[model samples]
Target: MAGSSATGLATLLPGAAEAAQKGVLTGFDLARRQGFPMLRHGPFGLIANPTSVDATGVHIADILHETAGVPLAAMFGPEHGFRGSAQAGKSEARSRDARTGLPVFDIYAKSGDALTAIFRAAGIGCVVFDIQDVGVRFYTYISTLFDSLVACARLGYEMIVLDRPNPITGLDCAGPVMQPGYESFIGRAAIPIRHGMTVGELARLFNAAFVPALAGRPARLRVVGMQGWSRDMWYDRTGLIWVPPSPNMPSLETAIVYPGTCLFEGTTLSVGRGTTMPFAYLGGPEVDGAAWVAALRRRALPGCVFRETYFTPGFSRHAGETIMGLELIVTDRQAFAPIPTALTMLSDALRLAGKPFWSDGGRTFDLLAGDGDTRAMLERGVAPERIVAGWQPALDRFRARRSGYLLYS
Candidate 1:
């Protein structure tokens, strides 16, 4: 009842309320207390996007160039372009940054010789990655960071990571580990679906795991961490700006539903792209929203609710056609786990359809879930609760292994 009196967390966990407010810190804020003084005269290339801003909305790249004279040699664009213009599955090629006046290279798809060439051409002594990650493994910004670190190692450049909050708390790691063969651009490493580690914490893990693969051999790594960040805090608690990392991820509300709804992307259901709502709505042309919501309501999944509705997406999957689906309302983010929520919905939806209700691609859910286990469980008529229970052992093992690399508790 101590934290609960003023914070209203009396029944909730001790730190639950504070954790909700503190999200990822902005790069400009990080620079003030971080080792930014040294970068004032150093040659540097910024690996960042529009989200790398100060608390008051000052862009980090502009701040570094105008004030510090760090010589912004090359601007490395992540999944989204330097200005956050590109879409999913594609990276913006070389383009002129209107604000920074620097050559923005596309590192979204660059690798091996191409990556080596980018650094060699820029000839900068240090490479700094300051992009924001949604704290989910499927979100690809962290993968871009990993690839850049690999490049820095190979090119013998000083790799300094400016720390940001994980947006999600770093305390909870959930979902199945990325098995060996399922690794793709979306998942470059064997981390959980919700990795819960900040980009800096992940950088520390990379230094330990792939020391041999680092380009220059040894990890020439340095991390400038935040002063007030804690492992218990989530994004909203950080008092940082919430810039949508991509087009589909419209808000933290949408992101709360994404971990599960995203698996629908590999299927025929419309995961609500191209419309203003984005991931907030999920439905397909053949879906019966009323029936689906009614069925899901019976399950009474914790911390979430479903609103039966009909929608038409402008593009992406079921474009321009009215479809019935369910809208996920996450009333309690702390108690809601998107992975389990999604699995339950997907299983229920499949069963309700009855006529083999999947889109043309059978078992495509396997790819999205990163293995056949989830799909097989769904197919074998296993409920969502059982499916989650099945993966607990693997998840536990991964947590034990990842414990060594954890920078924060």
Candidate 2:
């Protein structure tokens, strides 16, 4: 309502670039095409979710089970359950997948010795990880990968990663690095918030940087990379079907803003969890929706626009309460910086809403932000630019460390 109030949001978005839907085959697809050669070493367990599928929508566990020689020893599910029926911080109960008839074990928030026990109980010599990640540190799937890597390394299990695209293009990395002592299920290893690496690349990074500390060694790792996918390619460009990795993550647009808006979850505000546009909408009952929109709009943040809106969440945060906020309209994917954008909105909301902008004891925000610096910085009336600038040193160091693990250019 401030910056370009006279113009519609569509006017701020970038023009159509190229409609190149180049056929991109994910690691699972390639592995399936090649007759699941990696699993030939066999009787392997799979750590997967509903997101682990091919272009035709066939689940990985089902494919392996039907394969002639590849033994689908067991199945493991991460957060949101193996079938993806659960919600945030919750997972599906241990039950048999009705379709594949395979027993699904819960590995949601497990790690180290606990995960090792799961590995042992599975009675498999190898473990395969295939889950779609939205290219952020707090996404938990990567943490699942890291914990599984630690367990595999210690247990001497052959680990294979069926690499997937980082729905958000892998070309850019942003946000603050997680500091020491803030480790939790949300932010486990020390990495930047919006880490631009696929599961395969992250596996390499985890194995090289962290597994040694946790397991005294790195697991025997093999990553099956995606064919025809480059660092610059986003999900829309990859020609892969969009599957909601979790209930709230409905589309590629959700993944785009997630690394930034997800920080709102640390605050008392609802990050559109119960609404249809989760991560794309942000508001609280106390938030002055028009003021928040106008403040954000005045900043003229690149690649996005703020439009005033309202919604009643079915659950989470201000459940059953009609709350007002702004719906994010991302216009230019290449130019959009989600973490910085979200921080700007957050600082504005905190300034406008005052005491109402609190969270679940602030520990969740600290963990999500990697440390308490961001929250403290915002509370101290620091500008968003300065707060973002503070992250560059740590972000640069993380980028350097992660470069060695990158699989594609």
Candidate 3:
């Protein structure tokens, strides 16, 4: 576990401090500006995606390939391909990078000995991980990170993480902790659904808390922490350009509602995938848009409004068939509670659709919820408020456990 430690706030290069006064500087931004000092451990393989770029939108793989003295041996892509060409739950096949000509390996769905072999075959002793995360436990990038850490620890290799802002802000956390026996690629830890942590902070937590038990020791890790980032600053306020981390997660608006609405994936509802507004629009063929909106309006949820709408998705659920549902319009992000809001939406949708709403008898829903109790409560027609209230004790424990690993104030 030598060199297994996260750095404090990165040092700003000359003129960078003044530039940072205007907005936050990401770990990649600071590393690039400071001349890629972390790449000193040469012949490093990079685990990255389309979101791994500097402030000027320069891709890290390309920059590393051209940088002098930095031996970047290969590239690794997560759920999305390195260039982000694939869709959800898919990745591009192994190929040579068009720009850098570096060999690209698909690390999506890879872990344990299979993943460690990938690292061994790459002929590298270190891996640099950089990807934008939306701060939800089920988002999958963090899962990729966790698997990578375990593999690195097994192989006795080093892992350097380039941290980014949690687009939703790390002010609070909610939702149920992922129970044991429910570990999937979407969630492999006992963390809350809306895990209010950056990839760097999660790396620290994973290395210290979870990696040891799985790998027999912690990974030799280092996190290049971001400068100018605060716990309360959302990605929009950080002055960084939005790069879609996945094909479906196109905008920050989609990410804001994803933690809760993503639970719909385990249901019969079309979460607006393959449409212009995924996650923001929720509906199905049986849904009554007008009635759903009216019921939601009666609830008077904070920081958001529901509008009756109709959409025909090009792909994924209700394709080419116009479905009735309501669009979620978040008015004040600061006041919007995504999990509770979504729970309310789910309760209302269940009342409208009945048992059919629980796709696969709530198996997938239970996984997405991190526990089966949520689906069970919803099935019993429990109010979203009571369901959310039941989560406070667990949430409080998680928050307290999470505070010690937090890097940013």
In terms of lDDT, the poorest run of 10 residues in model 1 is 4-13
Query: Per-residue CA lDDT of candidate 2, range 279-354, in tens?
Result: 8888986679999899888899999999999888777898888888889999998899999999999888988985
RMSD (Å) per prediction? 7.0, 8.9, 2.9
lDDT of 1 at 136: 83
Tens digits of per-residue lDDT for model 1, 1-409: 1111111001111222333454444434656645466476567888888778778788888877786546678788878687888877777888878876888888886766788788778868878888777888778888777777777777777777777777767777777777777866677777878877877777767665754454546446666656456777767777777888887777777766776678877666888887767777888755678988998899899999989777888877878888778788888888988888888888877776645455555545555567767777787898788888888888888777667655544
Best candidate, lDDT-wise?
3
Error of 2 at 390 (Å): 1.2
In model 3, residue pairs whose N, Cα or C atoms come closer than 3 Å (at least 3 residues apart or on different chains), thus clashing, are none
Top candidate (TM-score): 3
Could you arrange the candidates by lDDT from highest to lowest? Answer: 3, 2, 1
lDDT of 3 at 4: 27
Steric clashes per prediction? 15, 0, 0
Q: Is candidate 1 or candidate 2 better by TM-score?
A: 2
The CA root-mean-square deviation of candidate 2, after full C-alpha superposition on the true structure, stands at 8.9
User: Model 3, 4-123: lDDT tens per residue?
Assistant: 243222222223355456688878877887788778766899999999988789998888899889999999999878899988889989999999989999999999889999999999
Comparing 1 with 3 on lDDT, the higher-scoring candidate is 3
TM-score of each: 0.88, 0.93, 0.95
